[model samples]
Target: MNVSVELTFTPLQNEYEPPISAFIKRVRASGFTVLENPLSTQVYGDYDGVMHMLTKEIKNSLSNIDIGLFQMKIVKTDRSSYVADF
Candidate 1:
């Protein structure tokens, strides 16, 4: 099954932009279709692949920074059906 996720990363530091930017870049580089917004980033792809990549990247990001928050809302559906185009 495919999946879609709305993810938000918050770094608990004075300088937060770099970590957030790096996280989004890693998500994009993972090959999932990424739709970035002001609040959260939406990712779409196969369930296993998306979850696996997200887990790995989030872990890597947190390990490097050591202080941050990761939030997500996941659904077992395609992006087209889950959310309408703008």
Candidate 2:
């Protein structure tokens, strides 16, 4: 089944956007696409694939940054469409 994961990370610094951008780029490079905004980031892909990258890779990468807020949500998609596509 297809899954969609949404994550929000609030960086503690003003220069957080670059790291967030880099993290998103890394997600895309790993074959998962993302829709990122100032407050949140969302990714859509296979369940395990999306979870692995989000919970493991993304969290690990952001751990080094001074982050203030972090939240994640995963949902099953009834259609093969991106969150932004709807």
The most accurate candidate by TM-score is 1
The residue ranges of model 2 lying beyond 4 angstroms of the native Cα positions read 78-86
Give lDDT for model 1. Answer: 0.88
Cα lDDT of candidate 2 equals: 0.71
Per residue, candidate 1 scores C-alpha lDDT tens digits across 1-86 of: 88889999999989999989988998989888888889999999899999999999989889878588999999888773454658
Work out the TM-score per prediction. 0.89, 0.71
Candidate 2, residues 43-70, lDDT tens digits: the string is 8888877777776766666676876566
What local lDDT score does residue 60 receive in model 1, on the 0 to 100 scale? 85
The TM-score between candidate 1 and the true structure equals 0.89
Q: Candidate 1 regions off by >4 Å?
A: 80-86
Kindly report the root-mean-square deviation of model 2 from the true structure over all alpha carbons. Answer: 3.1
Backbone clashes in each candidate structure, one number apiece?
0, 0
